[model samples]
Target chain A: MKTVKEGEIRRREILDVARELFVTKGYDHTSVNDILKIVDIAKGTFYYYFASKEEVLEAIILDIVEEGARRAEIIVKDQSIPLLNRIMMAIMAQTPEFEGSEEIKEELHKVENAKLERLYLKAMLKRMTPVLQEPVLECIKEGIAHMEYPTECIETILLLGHMMFDCDTFEWKMEEYPQKIQAFLCHAERMLGTKEGELSGFLQMFGQMP
Target chain B: MKTVKEGEIRRREILDVARELFVTKGYDHTSVNDILKIVDIAKGTFYYYFASKEEVLEAIILDIVEEGARRAEIIVKDQSIPLLNRIMMAIMAQTPEFEGSEEIKEELHKVENAKLERLYLKAMLKRMTPVLQEPVLECIKEGIAHMEYPTECIETILLLGHMMFDCDTFEWKMEEYPQKIQAFLCHAERMLGTKEGELSGFLQMFGQMP
Candidate 1:
């Protein structure tokens, strides 16, 4: 039993070191040898933990999903905040941006990783959408009850928000990223039947706008 | 000179047959053998014209780009129509939906072909953007002059329109495709400073809406 626990710990350690290296050197540039060297583990031990570098990358993605779910759970349970705010928080929580390394985020945006990054995003969205859906609908219900949102096409607007803002499909310009976020938020707010500038503070709180 | 002209005709014939097979059978399912069977051409003659099946697909994509550019040129030159209408027409023209087979459109959307399709789209956008940029801007200028559209963020809205509508990134439901198009156009009209329902007739004309 102790050996099994130790093995699990060792596996996690390998993932931690590999993830850091992937963030700094990028997934393609960070070879298995580099991971072995950093973790000071033998080749056989590394192989025992992960079948290949791709497998390790996939494990890292799963770990992110798990972490995002945990964060979302906490935000969703916070009854102190308004339901709509909680929904926005819950959605933002699923994005890897909040606690993730900026360097890793930038590394994933490189041209060589575009295909892999899109795959990761699709997987993450698939995982995150279900976790967010019911909570968001509850929030939408509250918004409608409060006379703050339209009820005609609630589902479509939720999907639009998920695809357009919550996911990383749109490229953000470094200089104009805030402006873009503001514009998107304004549009989303309008679509949801929220008054203009209602969600502006959420954008500021999420660090997406000034 | 007569022989060269005949050879050119033969090359076009090969492409026509290959395109039809690719549309009906998909790029992966349509082997060079199938194209050969359809065209009844010698392997040597086929190889003399094209290097590989991928090369032929690339040629087809180039042909599409050429045709789209031709259509765009006509739409952009027609000053009889309103500027915003021309811009909308120019965008709708670039999409393969206007002329290509629905089977080919569906084939390009398959999971196995997602990467290849994205590459094709990126290539198409890169090639087509430059050709359409001047005319689009001129239309924007006309829109602004006519007070039908906003002036401050013309380029951004154009980019948004191209990315949101021209690309096949968003999946449309069979039943709700028309409704989604209407919502998108309404949002875009609002963003562009046009009055609501201003572009409804254009969507109806495109057969995207009843």
Candidate 2:
């Protein structure tokens, strides 16, 4: 392997330290001084990479969004995959925000401080929309062509599903059950008017077969 | 109509004043004195009915929960209605606790008062749970009976739907479009594994024409 660059290594170290400190001490509760002491980096160096604490947060969020967008696009493009399998793959691929414990807890605790919660929520919805939309839209096209579920309500279902996923705070416990997640996705595909047994096998493919 | 009792009228008037005030001044910022002032009652008179400000808040919540529970049960018992229809109707039936202009302004001025926000959130969720649960259980039942969708995930959907509705701060300009709401609900019901056209004619029933 080629030798790692000083800048890349240093920046990665900074993010790791910052993420831990932010997670443990909280964003508002943790200060620049604490980060400096923990990482042993000059404040100037920290400032060189990040203009403000908010900028660091912005970087972290961008990481989530960029990764989310990539995964969503990848699954959406895999047209040969069955709709339900693609849905399951998309879910596991995206992992959403809650899937990250350190990230989820820290963000929630710091929500009162960052003024970031609402924006974060909106970003989350936007992030997931394509992951859901691409497959559902394709499925709808097929369903309509074949005259499956009523065509009149297609857009309505899509928007509502989008809103619900955007806003709903399914208990954290539910995440513990992968079977449940798979089931729900199947339910969504079915509503889009996919034929039965067509997507049934997908239920077993998302995160540990139930 | 028969004359309303002085005590009953006075109590409801107090609850009305307290609910509005709690939303505005916040649970902590607005005290017993403020509620009494708004209701035009003396401190001792307020104490006569409610031992403390919390009690008055509790009374308001209890009223909401009781009414919500009653309505939710009624929806649960309707065999003629589709499962998705019941869930959407239940959501429509329960009043959403929107922060009024005054309340939003006050909270903005204070900024980042988490404890107060959490308390208000808890009280509101308590009022909302029954309104949210019936459809979840129904989805499970219907999914299993028809082998419709994964019966297991319905719980997560309900749990998430409640929290999202409670915590979501997005500007909802779309509620005015009842067709959109109907489409979303019908689709969501399908996502939970019910059949299409299950809620056909649902929009007209709500008095929204094609």
Candidate 3:
């Protein structure tokens, strides 16, 4: 039991070291010997934790995506937050990828990396999709409950997704930001035919959409 | 005279051939011999055209960015379209790098490459900054010209630039989108305490900020 616990702790330490070195020196310049020097681990021990550097990279990508899904779940579930605002918060989680490895960038062009990116995108979209549908649904429900009629709430919801939340073939460099995204949601509300004052409080709660 | 002109033409063809090769086969894999075989130009001709493969790469980067700047300028100046809409269109050029070179990713990290990136960024900003500023300026000008005083045009302009235009940082990526921008614009208009929507068309001009 003691040996097993010690092995698990040591493996975690190795992963931590690998991540820092990979992000800094990048995967190419970083060698097994470099990992050994940094982690103070034997070759056999390092192999025990990860089969190859590529495996380690796969792990990192999964970890980042998983963390994002977790964040999206937390933010999306808050019923007090309007659906539109929550969707924005969830969208906020789509941070730029770490640019440590040009190798990674190259891989993005390849079939395998493309698939991985698609999987991650799908995961991200799933978490936030409900945030998109739910709020608009609630808004309509509120209107209906109050005996107010929206001639086209569902169409409005779909339009909001298309104009604001829809994806495009154009490359969105999550890395090179030079401005903020607040006007986007506010303008979205306006275009959705919601009055400024009524939806103002709702729009304001996005707290910076993920 | 004929010999000299023929030599210049041959040299130009070699660079063009090499450019296509690099894009398809990548820089490292494509060699001088490969370029010679494809262009059917002699080794001497290839050497005459480019001192080395690296010089050709630098030239390609210059051409791509320079051409992009020129195109952006054209789009920004088309007065037939609404200025705000043009500004958003201008943003499409900004994202080209996201789907661009693996070479660029590697280059940005090296000291030489980092300096080059900074130079490129400065030049691109100089070219694109005018467009970013122009829409808001035009919106405000058009609004005030129509007697829309105490307006909230400034916030909308800034938010347009911050949110939709910039998407390159991990912070921007992580659910911390610059949401204050919405409040800043919305309240700025209301705080002016103006009755009626002097700025309603002003918002319309900016199109969708998202």
Candidate 4:
């Protein structure tokens, strides 16, 4: 058990170092050698943790998806929060972490690195969707139960919710974040046959994002 | 002038045959030599028209973008059609062509070719957006002139319209074509401050696609 714990800690340490390098230097510019040097790990030890740079990228994306799932799970289980608010919280959970990471912004926006960023984002969304689906569906069920949404078009509404929740992946501007969320919530209310202002509380909460 | 015309025709013939082969075989599987043989062109002739297979792919994407822009121009210029219908027509133009091409489906879905398809689609959208922007702006102007839309939110609404118009690139299902369009149009009407049922006629026409 001690050996297993040590191995896990070592793996996370490598990831932490790699993420720092990737954010500061950009993914393409940061070589495996750079990460190994930063972590001061032997070549074999580095290989033991991650097979290649692409695997490191996949690991980073997996970490993001896991975090999203974890947050979503917490929000869904919190019975005190309204269902719409819970759903909004689950979807909006990613933005704060992203906004907190100021170091990644310049690297992400570098013209030459845009494709790599898009590729990773696309991969992240594909992996994240399946993990978040359950919480999203539960929220939808609660919305239906509360008569806040119609029951007839569950599948379509679920699909639409997935797309709307993935607006970050859809490349919607962060500058227009409030308007986009408001517009999306208004449309979702229309689609689910709810009253116009039924989901306004969630929008009000989203507007307070720092 | 006659020599230029002949050169244009020859270039198009090469593109036509190459497109057929690309649709039938995968892009990676279809070599330049294969295209040359099929078109009965000398190696020098092939090189004269295109530097590489990548260039051919770029040319094909350019063709698609040009066609979209051309259709957008026609729809926007036609004063007889209602402005809402013109906007709907511009968005709908690409779907039928995409749906009708059964051969391209296999190539597009191939795992090895997915990256190439994505790269080309990204390039096509980049080129297509500016071209379509004019017609889209005109539609919004007409909407505002008729007091169907608010003038203050023109920029945001324009951005939203571009997103809505790129639904083909968004990969919304042809299976959910009618529902997607109706839901989209209804939401668009709300966003643009138009009366309910104003855009329903376009949805009726879209449902007749066969």
The numbered model that scores best in DockQ is 2
Return the TM-score for each candidate structure.
0.58, 0.58, 0.43, 0.58
Docking class of 4: incorrect
List the candidate 1 regions with Cα displacement exceeding 4 Å: A1-14, A24-29, A34-51, A98-103, A131-175, A206-210, B1-70, B76-88, B96-210
lDDT of 1 by residue, B10-60 (tens): 999999998888877777798888888878988888999999987787677
User: What is the per-residue lDDT of model 4 for residues B42-69, given as tens digits with 9 covering 90 to 100?
Assistant: 9999899899986786576567656765
* Candidate 2 stretches greater than 4 Å from native: A1-17, A23-29, A36-59, A78-84, A96-119, A140-179, A197-210, B1-17, B23-29, B32-63, B74-88, B97-179, B188-210
Q: Considering only chain B, report the TM-score of model 4.
A: 0.65
Fnat of every candidate, listed in order:
0.02, 0.31, 0.00, 0.02
Mark the 10 consecutive residues where model 2 chain A has the least summed lDDT. Answer: A144-153
Cα lDDT listed for each candidate: 0.63, 0.55, 0.50, 0.57
> Alpha carbon lDDT of residue B178, candidate 3?
34
State the RMSD for candidate 4.
7.3
The deviation in Å at residue A72 for candidate 4 is 12
Clashing pairs in 4: none
Tens digits of lDDT, candidate 2, B62-156:
56546655676677668786766766576545533333634532443343543333444444455555555556666666562243333333443
**After TM-score superposition, what is the CA distance of residue A9 in candidate 2 from its true location, in Å?**
14
Give the best candidate by lDDT.
1
Q: Could you arrange the candidates by DockQ from highest to lowest?
A: 2, 1, 4, 3
Given candidate 2, what's the lDDT at residue B81? 69
Model 3, position B113, has a per-residue lDDT of 44
